[model samples]
Target: EAAKVRLADGQGREIACDGVLLTGQFTPESSLGRQSHLQLDSGSDGPKIDQYGRCSDPAYFAAGNLLRPIETAGWSYREGRRIGSLMALALCNQLPAPHDALTLKYAAPIKLGVPGRLVRGELAGLQHIQLRVSRAVSGTLRVRAQGLDLWSRPVSALPERRLLIPLKELQLPEHLDQLDICID
Candidate 1:
């Protein structure tokens, strides 16, 4: 609804405004997944899915909506298509075994990360690391590996909003394999 908002006082005149913004709390419906013994994402209140949407229970697979309730229809469709294709490949034993895949854990302020995990061998093509901030903050977000700074960026984060860290140019040293993102 785009309309003038009435002033708080008992006045007839409406306040001039471009538009009205309305919002409500959005709960990620993941209790069923959790009840079924799936790993719940600490950051998103959703299932912790792998790069291919596989849940902890090998018999189960979740993509798109079941993974992230706030996703758009187009994104959900893409996830389904991509994960379905990958599942088909796995059924035929065409997919290669993951080599030294590790989870992307975080410290305080960062609740969760998309791709919850990544293959160490896949770092060369790493593109994005998305997370939900615990609260609004204005500071430098840093990714540290083995207590050494690996990457950093200025961030203005809002709760529940996707905070993306682009990693297209990341160059990891051979000795340091694990990384953690924290607000500094």
Candidate 2:
């Protein structure tokens, strides 16, 4: 006898409904980046980027949620802006020429680091080597180059978060042959 629709049942009582609102969590749309074959972060659902937001492909760049599932709008905007500026520098030949890039691989539970590739002469700053773990761990975080131990430290890894690696303290060679990061 009523025109209103019932929303749901509560203890055998019907509740009135004004309208149905579809709500759900959002996810990052990284299909284009993935389709382009850019290196993806092991712990995240988006492309990996260097400090300047350059992807494995020097010609490509990513920032914000495109490089990770979640990030603040301000952070993303600043990142993109910085990357754009860097790109302009590169294009204008103001920055150093592109150098040989090294790739970092990880083992179980250790997700991929951002800027998966390290270009020669490029810096690995105190906060540049960010990592994410799938679960909690207590182990050695080892970084090696050319099969020689460069840096290692004990860490308490956590899930769904970023963990920074301090590479500047290692005093890596200006031109690296092979560089890697792992946990054991």
Q: Write one digit per residue (lDDT tens) for candidate 1, span 1-184.
A: 2455556785555556777667655546677996877778776767875565566654566676676557667866876887788677667755444444456677768766766655444413224676777678888888777787778889888876777777554566666546778887
Q: What's model 1's TM-score? A: 0.69
Task: Indicate the residue-level lDDT of 30 in model 2.
Answer: 87
**TM-score of each candidate?**
0.69, 0.69
Model 2, span 1-184: residue lDDT tens: 2234444663343346655555333335688977887867755667866555577666877766777655568866876777677777767756544455566666667755665655545532213676767689889888887777788888887764667776466666767755777778
Cα lDDT listed for each candidate? 0.67, 0.65
RMSD of candidates 1 onward, in order: 4.8, 6.2
Error of 1 at 125 (Å): 9.5
**Residue 62's C-alpha lDDT in candidate 2?**
73
User: Candidate 1: lDDT of 116?
Assistant: 66
lDDT of 2 at 1: 25
Q: What is the lDDT of residue 38 in candidate 2?
A: 80
